[model samples]
Target chain A: MGAVKQTLSLAVEQHARDRLARESEAQLHGMWVVIPAYNEGKMVGEVVANLVTLGLQVVVVDDGSADNTQAVAKSAGAIVLRHVTNRGQGAALQTGIDFVLGQKASVVVTFDADGQHSAEDIPALVATVRDEGADVALGSRFLGKMHGAGLGRTIFLRLSTFVSNRLSGLPLTDSHCGIRAISASALRDLRITQDGMAHASQLLYSIARHRLSWKEVPVTIRYTEYSRAKGQNVTQSLRILFDYFFHRSRGGQP
Target chain B: MIIRAVFLVLLALLTFYVFIQRRRLPFNLIVMSLIVVAAVAFILRPEMSDPIANYLGVGTGADLITYLIQVGLIFATVHYYTKFSTLQSEMTKVVRELALLQHKVERLTETEEQTGVGRDRGRAAS
Candidate 1:
């Protein structure tokens, strides 16, 4: 009876361990990280290497960068995809998403290649989709630690968030956060066509249109001098605004 | 009379060229056909434009024709602009797809060569 009791406890312990292993495996099994990069050759290698070390499959879509972004990303252990000419960030992202979806990835995460996003935040975002019932998990800088953002950028981000919130009606803390995780199911229901910075606003519009459940998680975004130099400036914001206006005027869907 | 004759000859030549290339440029043919029909109407019955112009708040028949030409020019400008934008969007899509495919092919070739080399090494070891 003593031996039998020991055996039974061992069996129970094995079952619990198996369940935990299966749960974690399921959490990461179909997760893919897509990075849309334009002229980010200088930083893409390190960015991709960082994500690869996290054990996530990474795909880098080089948006026709004149630099050696493709070679750098491939050398860093990423599946490198390229655009022949510079389609904007939105188009690059759509290409990456389409490619990953074809590979049967269940969860797709969009990470910026400017090295602004922390790879550490990815697990929680994936968990939000895998364990929780959320279809879209957006990483909000406002909710978490943010470094390197200046006063002017802060006001611009806040103003854009307010305007985008009113326009898209998502009403979250941050509207234009680049790091976002989307489920394959929600992605099927959504289509991105703006091919520009206005694509962020379009994403929120898609969320509202499809009525997909979404949640925000705190994420750290580093605004280094390199990233800031590569980032969109004031004139680009006006161009993005004009793009959204033109897109809305044309009935808004591709 | 000389101007009308020259105009009709030019219209005939345009119609012939458009019809010949109808399969490749169907939109151009349809547009040119409409313009030819309108020009023929004006040439045959110059009086018709006067009433049309008066209704459009112009004074004389020649004035009305001139106004109609301006309207046609504006319409053509808008039409071509729309066409140009659509073509530009299509071009972007094609370029993006081409880039992706080219990279994919290059990657596949490299993988094949690497595997081939590895296979040779394995045979030598055996």
Candidate 2:
């Protein structure tokens, strides 16, 4: 039994090394890091700086923020796109993805402007997409273990995971994590019609409809005081779930 | 009382004609069913019409029921018309955005073609 366990461990280590090598090649081809900001002027600059240090072409889409988010992000050496009006997060993400595709980026990575996502974990997501031959790599907070999540947030994540898994048949442990990396082909095919929180659910449905290969990797999510306060409460979460079903029933895009 | 029966029969015939002419079989069938029920009730127990009206809070005969039904149908028609108007406005916004994006793409393609021509001339000169 001990020898068998050692053999499995060795295989896992070899697989990890192979994945790292593939990610290095993807990085050399240039990955566009897209941060969708909406009134996150305070945190957007720091997020852009961190991504720039990681050698990724950073593009920050300011979704008609009522603050200086665009100016700060531009000052931080990131390309900034400003919306004329407040189109929701999904629209902002679509704009950034369109711009990145125009720039001929090989891989596009999405990060939240709230600073909850760590730029250091980007390579792991890119590696998962490249090595496993997956179209998209999603960062999962509840995959291996829960880290630094409050009780309320933990319950919300579990309920969302349950609903998403049942609906998409993907068995995802985290459905709403903003940290994800998609290949250029997948990004080009994605059509985001929903403008609000329902866009997240729409993306998963699109992936399933297209029969795209995807995987979830464990990653740490930082919840600062400001982020926790601004994050969706239980009431908002239920509303988003109801909106997803209502829109689906109306024959609207996910 | 005989005059009222004749009037109801004419109304039922007109409704059936409208349904058939419009090809609205489902709505026609529903209205026809209601007319049949009203006709049977009138024929079976004509004296009970006043009591049925009072039960419906109409305080009158079948005439009051006809008035109430007409008002309700009109209200529903107006409500649906307003809903259709709202949907038209939303569609206009979506079409405008699509047109803008298409124009942007066209300009970008034109610039690329122009650059390609310049590069070809430079290569030939070299």
Candidate 3:
């Protein structure tokens, strides 16, 4: 009986040590942040610099920018990937995701490079995925301090969220939030093929389709004059709706 | 009468062109030949369609032809729309592949440069 107790104690001690080692190792594991940019050379440099300052690995996919977005992002210490043509945001994001997955990123975050997203919010997104056991941590503007969006824009966003929720069957406050963090395993199971603004809704559809564990975290969205001028407007909402339904009518192949 | 003869001649020429390209354009030949035969029958005998239209319960022969043309145009529109969408999807795929290839090449070059610099440092240390 003493021998059995001793052997069990030894195995328990070994298991405890292994768990501690894993926890410590996880503390040092960094995440990959992918910023899909299109002619945002004016702001991509600052965005990349801010993310790099936060000690996160950043990759900027310049979606065939007519300007010098690639050069600016690279000079800001970000890995620069360029599309041959303007394949839109969805294609740019998929390119960045595949590249980072190849590099073995533990967690992946999709960030916008239009200077609307705050780098400080990235940690919450990453922590939600890391510590909270969530497959996807989506950032919501409505849940956070939403500044600079007018009443018209706010109503449009809410209407879009309603439509997206109905289509995806998931109650999400903001469906078009450009900031989101996902685990490597969840990303491996996802295939984003919308190749346009409709990707935001498509992501929600995929989350519901794959039954991924998701949680919403409040994140600040700084909509500056420059960002607002360059950002998508009400017209794009219509286009996005059309694209989503068209993709669905085609058996959701996109 | 002269107009009818002119149409008949034009149809004959079209038939000849279709026959010459029959192997390469079998479906087009059959469709065009049918159209020509129908036009010839309509011009030669305007009263022939009355029985067919009556049998189909259409108001008149002219109305029946109009309805048939409308249906054909609608079908063509649907077919072209589907084709356009497929092409668009294919274009998106091609653009994505090209972007990925560009990224891969950049990564490969960066890796090669780093390795080359590492080799230089090792030689100096040795």
Candidate 4:
């Protein structure tokens, strides 16, 4: 009986040691950067390169781009998933999230492929999610002291913020920022059904539904001429609003 | 006259069948309401029915209107069915992609586990 007890105690100690080692390994696990690219072949490679330099695993979902986005992202050491048809930004993001979650990513960061999102801001967002106990960390351009946003874009973002806050009852300062970090739990639980630009609203609704804690940190979005041209226009903004309300009226959430 | 009577009975049967089929309630309601209105009109003014039937392209007024409405409803139903099928196809594509990605992740996790086990064995041997 004494021998058996000794053996059992040793086995328990070994199990505890193994658990500690696994926890340490998890702490060192890298972040997965998911970039949804739709014909931004020019900037995708650069974005992937920057994220790679930051020691993050990158996955680029090429949403049926007519350009060489898939080739460029693959060449840049990014796991590339190509959709056969042109799905919208929301669908592309869903694919990216699925890929990143598959990669066993401890944290997932969604960065725009249009070079608007600064790679330098990625670490800050990831740190916020890790250290602040936040389920998701959003990069907000309006929260911090930032400059160089066009008047039109600022107004549009404000309108979106107002609508999202009213609908979701979440105190979010910037609801439309593309740069965000989601914990593994949040990523696994998020069910993004929006197939178009209305995904921003969907994300907010999902966060509210899941009751995930989120924070918005100050980040800079460099709006280059190319990115500005490809960005959402006034008409697109109206269409997104229309789609959101239409889906809601049809008993669809987000 | 027998042919007309048979056609009227068939129309009444179709209208009754629409109501009996629970899945198409909204459609059945619209169709049955139209049929009831037409029936009431014919019963109220039997003389006007013959003139209206002559003006229409059919042998009888009730036959022409019923045929027209049925054709229109069938076309509309076909259009909605196509839309539903398209949505189903899109949803299937999304689900298939997600499943493929999930499988890839499972394989990756297995590989990682095997590698970790191998590393542990080597350390223990040393």
Q: What is the C-alpha lDDT of each candidate?
A: 0.87, 0.78, 0.86, 0.80
Over A1-254, each residue of candidate 4 has an lDDT whose tens digit, in order, gives: 99999999999999999998787556547588888888999999998998776566888888888999989998998888777777788888887787677667789889999888888887788888999889999999887644556888889888879987887888888888989999998977786767788888888888898889998988998887888888887689788888677667666675
RMSD of 1: 6.6
Best of the two (1, 4) by DockQ: 1
| Model 3 per-residue lDDT tens digits across residues A138-168 | 9999999898999887898898899889988
TM agreement with the true structure for every prediction: 0.76, 0.65, 0.80, 0.68
| Model 3 segments more than 4 A misplaced | A1-30, B1-59, B111-126
Tell me, by TM-score, which candidate is best: 3
Residues B8-114, candidate 3: write the lDDT tens digits: 89878977877887476677767777887897897677678778899999988877878988998999997898788778768877876776787778777788787
Checking candidate 4 for backbone clashes, the offending pairs are: none
The i-RMS of every model, in angstroms, reads 1.7, 5.8, 1.6, 4.3
lDDT tens readout by residue for model 1, A96-151: 98888888999999999999999999988887987797999999999998899999
Model 2 residue A211 CA deviation (Å) reads: 1.0
Top candidate when judged by DockQ against the true structure: 3
C-alpha lDDT (0 to 100) for residue B83 of candidate 3: 87
In model 2, which residue pairs have backbone atoms overlapping below 3 Å? none
